[model samples]
Target: MADKDPASVQTDESTGQPEKSAQELVLVSEVLPDRIPVMPVYPRPVFPHFMLPLTFSGEKFLEIIREAIEKHNGLLGLVMISELNEQNYLASGLHTVGTVARIYRCSQVSEESVQIVVQGLQRFERVRVAVREEPVQLWEVRYHYDDRAVSVEELKPHILAIMASVKELLSVNPLLQEQLKALLQQVSYERPHMLVDLVSSVLTAEPAKLQDLLETFDMRKRCEKLLLLLKQEIEVFQMQDKIHKQIGEKVGRQQKEYFLREQLKAIKKELGLEKDDKTQEIEKFEERLKNLDVPRDVLDVIREEIDKLKMIDTHSPEYHVSRNYLNELTLLPWGVYSKDNININRARKILNSDHYGLDDVKERILEFISTIIKKGSVSGSIICLQGPAGRGQNLGRPLNCQCPRT
Candidate 1:
């Protein structure tokens, strides 16, 4: 496998100097170690012609990796962890199909940690576990080649279909378009297998699904899988874009309504319409308060409510509720007092005239009127004339008797 200059550079942590660039070519004819130290990577599978950055901790693990870098020319096997448990990695428990990675750059992160950038060289399958213990986890791996028996002519249609899907993806997914365009410029249709590997690495898919594509050696089958993934990605992007546009339109309409309402308010103020209405309403409330002699505490509350109403938006429901409360408050008879004008004989005569054969009810009302006259007020007292419906209750006879309005 060969590639141009890598897209990223890793700097040494201690020395603060850039590492050597991985611009050299690696041919298939070059010697590769059959047994190599294997490291477990997680979440994503590495594809050939792709670079993955990995972090390692523990002094023993770092030392083992350092020995592999020194003795094996930085060549190692990286396999994805089937389970996410970190303990599984220490036991050399990983998927069999993995990539043969070459260390492109290494950096000392700290005393117990190291970071390395590796470029996948080829697809490899673990033949056997050579060593599985602390500080040493080696695997005997065999490299596999992409099916080359099929000529380029046989893959032209597949290649075209993938490119078309990529184009569709480019139109919907602008965030990844730059990287996709860069990859497109680097890849050629002649190397359909390489294109499939490199392109599939960047596209979004499940790790297991990507691993399945990575293990697929047949060029035609890999192309088919890659095309399907690209189409699915396009669909996801399209759906996401549709949801975003709907949210944007709804927000835009609300903003437009708010803006128009504000503009209308400004126009009305300019024409002396809105300000005059608000001022007139406030003046009417104040006038009512003056006529009724509202209590000082209640006056303060009503004034505060009016102030709040002024600050609130006229189109808001709170404004109307506040205004109605203030109107009711100002209209109440806050300081109005009732006079003790009751006469027991006059009430008895009025009740006797209003109804017949209700002597007991008339007697009770006369006694209540006498109590009011004695107390000088009807405070802490209620006079309820109870009787059956349609009976001569004579609720209006008290008015004729000149009962004080309590």
Candidate 2:
């Protein structure tokens, strides 16, 4: 997939020469409002999509908006607030990197409210927050520049790889696959900014992760982060597919058993030797049960039930009940208790040795033991929990159960 040259950079085909002058690095801080009230777009914290329209309703914010409109180039640092609540907006944890957005349109909705639409241009990092008495906040920002320039040829392979991975991930959903294919085709190579925007739209990442990318001034790092995110998405799809297949097999087995029962009934009616077939099937099931290596107690009960079933008719109630019991017994976990040894001396030594600064834990254990002695006899079992295991054992009879006098 080749990217078309941006309109700004493209030259006349007839001239066969470079068309426009080299684009200048536009510094966005010059036009930005010095002390503008920042209103965070709550739902979309990271600005991956188009410019968002924000309302400035407070007295301080209204004045800031009016000043921005009057200047014809009021730029405000569009920052994301860390926490939003009724009391106050917590902007302390706000990312130092933010876009210096220029106000494009402004309209007065009401006496106190003003609606403003701003277009984000370039990224900036907040350097310092100046102390001020003005209603709005003021911060000194520096232009965070990305000097690395990637040529059109370099980006082609990367863009192609990204498109291929996306297609594979969305193959299960027809609608998403088509939409993603069209999106990849429409990306303009001439405008690297447009390509950046498109990649952001297609990938779904957490806000914190995206913020980390936005803070990065390096384009190479940004592309690497996007690739890593797409790879993670592919892994998620594979895990989901495995889970679906496992569930399907369980359902298939149940259906197979039901179908076999229906076939057996028809076979009995068609054949004249119905009694002989029934006797043979019962004998086969009994042999299989006896061969199974199960505990003697459970095996004895199963043998008795099978003997009773053989005496009853093939279509009798006893025969069906015995079949269900055998199936349940075969599925049970027999003689499978995990062996774990409880060493009281080792446990006590481990608890006291591992932690050097845990005086409270040691004190609590001593207090518990004191209570046990005062009671003459412990009422219930004592559980000594070590890590994941909870070991319980009864204390043997003692000559002196009462607590000793201090």
Candidate 3:
């Protein structure tokens, strides 16, 4: 195995940092008693990377620790375990490649408990796992190191682009901008691998996605992935801005319409067309009804409600008639809707299987499923029911109610 100092790498001139060192590496093999209980780390934890310290309390872990302490080397392999069952982790098989880590610190918390800090060094591929009486897993490991080095001139353009994207994203969020700016300054510009790790940590991708990037041995491929991630972050922020603007426009229109209606009502009362300022604005609605072209049946309903509103005070029953009429007209479906097909029996089965009690709630959910299954889909309709209220409670009607007519 070749032992080279990482600091000897060349620095990127533009960023003033050391370049990445390209050195072929070897993985050392370690033995773990199969009975010692082995935990495989799916995500690769790198050396000098600050990760949450894990506590190993199981009997197998204790046995493994005893052996490591006795051996004096204190070196262990970190392997990624394949999940066999979603709920059970012990049944999963371990992945072959894992980083060989050396214990930096170890402390005994209790008679049966042990705490240790291990720093990962290099990557290794596992050949096989053999069971032993000690309850610890034995791993056959082969080290693979990258010896290909790149100069500062080769990585400047990519680094510049990455910095620009970071700046753009930061402009939208000033707090994040400051943090990113500081990180960029602290990072050595010459070493692309370090930059890759730093950028990948901050990206919006999930932990699993980031792990995949870390496991990728190709330096160029890793940089490409990080750049792509940065581009996606920029696009997401832009889409969010567009959505906010659209919502603002919609709200502005609603506010303007409300203000205009109130002003028109005041003008009508002053001109004596309305009997009182408080009287429902039936005349205004009637004029609007005449301007709008619709089916005869809908027109007839609107005209009838307008006539009723003119005879009643603002607080009378007829006042609600006009309000309802306008609401119904404005809220009608102007477009077609594809019916949703629901399976009531399947829904009932699911509800029963997932929950313990609440028969009424389950029944209501099943009813809704039945409706969707029957009609394929229900038309847009509003149904309100008044229920008993408790202090600080806002319980609405149960969902079992049949759909109201549109």
Candidate 4:
């Protein structure tokens, strides 16, 4: 698609008119306002209730904005450039139908660009365009907006269908979960035409389709078309999600197979059944062993076990046990020691703070700790910790988690 002209930007400059959604439509009476400034939107149709923010450039549009704000107090016209004939933009390039919108804000975004916040006031058809030698265009339009009266009962089924489809779509998409939930709630009490228009804002489709929806003046038909669009969107999203999941699973399976094949290759090389450099495995083992800080006796024992492991056939059951033993040996803290910070005063304070009437236990713990300090070693293998049933009876079992059999 071709880029839209720089003159085609929506602008707004009013505040505190009414609390409404950018998607909520405002009712318009038959009273016709006179000539207003025209803004041609080549991009998308600004449906009723659309509070659209846009960026625009070009000096002609700026002049229109100036006249609209300074003279007319933020009142303007917007006609979408869709399937129209050879009508000149500077002369006549719009339909008899257009919108009367307000400028909520107009800010100079850059030297070449300006941002404008616009809200569609109401539909106005039977417009007469006024061209000028100057870079501005104006429109004299009459407001045209009316919808057939719709009973809530007649709209209930279609509304329920749309809600169900939206819910289903939202279920699969977690990112939209909270935001869509609020939007769905807001759609509940709106009129049928307003409800469909609000939903069109949420579910983006082709601009042409949106133009069709904006042209629909019947409330019942609008709801029906909106429900169909929602169902179609839901089906498309589901199919796309299924395809994505299938592709992901296929990729994962292929990756797993690749990893397994690489492992098998290495294993075959290690068993001297392949042509690859088989010594890399033993080199890796040697490098790992040299980095350890084991006692001399333990180190010698591990080296002898490694040699035995190299000579033995790995298919035997004894191979797994030998491997597990080596793994356990590597994990052991060979020369590590626990340095407990012990002070008699701090210990007394801790004991008193932790428990009342445990003076005897505290004294015994202090005496044992002193003996261990004097010896410069942990002298006992098992020290009984007496406490309430849940406090100490089986607390030390957690220490068993330090190593596992495999």
Q: Assess each prediction's global lDDT (C-alpha) against the native.
A: 0.78, 0.59, 0.59, 0.66
Q: What shift in Å separates residue 136 of candidate 1 from its native position after superposition?
A: 3.6
Reference-based TM-score of each model: 0.68, 0.45, 0.45, 0.54
Question: Model 1, range 1-406, lDDT digits (tens) per residue?
Answer: 2222233345788999766545323455455778888877778888988877889988776977887788778987878878776564565447889988889898999988999999888888888988776767888877775655687899999999998988898899888889878877887998887788878988888888898988887788889989888988999999999999999999999999999998998899899777645666788888887777777888889989888877887778987898888877876677775543476666667767777876787777778778877877767977664576533334545644323232
Clashing pairs in 2: 6-190, 32-75, 33-75
Candidates ranked, most accurate by lDDT first: 1, 4, 3, 2
Model 4 residue 319 lDDT score: 68
- Could you tell me the lDDT of residue 168 within candidate 2? 76
Q: What is the per-residue lDDT of model 2 for residues 129-207, given as tens digits with 9 covering 90 to 100?
A: 7544454555666655333366666776676666666767787434467756676676665555556655664455676
Clashes of 1: 0
Pairwise lDDT winner, candidates 1 and 3: 1
Q: Against the correct fold, how does model 1 do in TM-score?
A: 0.68
Global local distance difference test of model 1: 0.78
Clashing pairs in 1: none
Give the runs in model 1 whose Cα sits over 4 Å from its true position.
1-29, 57-64, 86-93, 110-112, 275-288, 295-332, 339-406
Error in Å for residue 96 of model 1: 1.6
TM-score top scorer: 1
Model 3: per-residue Cα lDDT over 1-406, one tens digit each: 3344464556789999666634422234433222222345544334222223556776667777666656536666665564555454444566555556667778888877888887555556655565545456666555544424555567777777777888888866555776577667767667665566666656666545555665677666766777887888788877887898899999999999999988887788789775553343554555555555667787777667666666667778766766777656744532323333355665566556655787986676666556656766557633333434431121111223333234
Among these predictions, the greatest lDDT belongs to 1
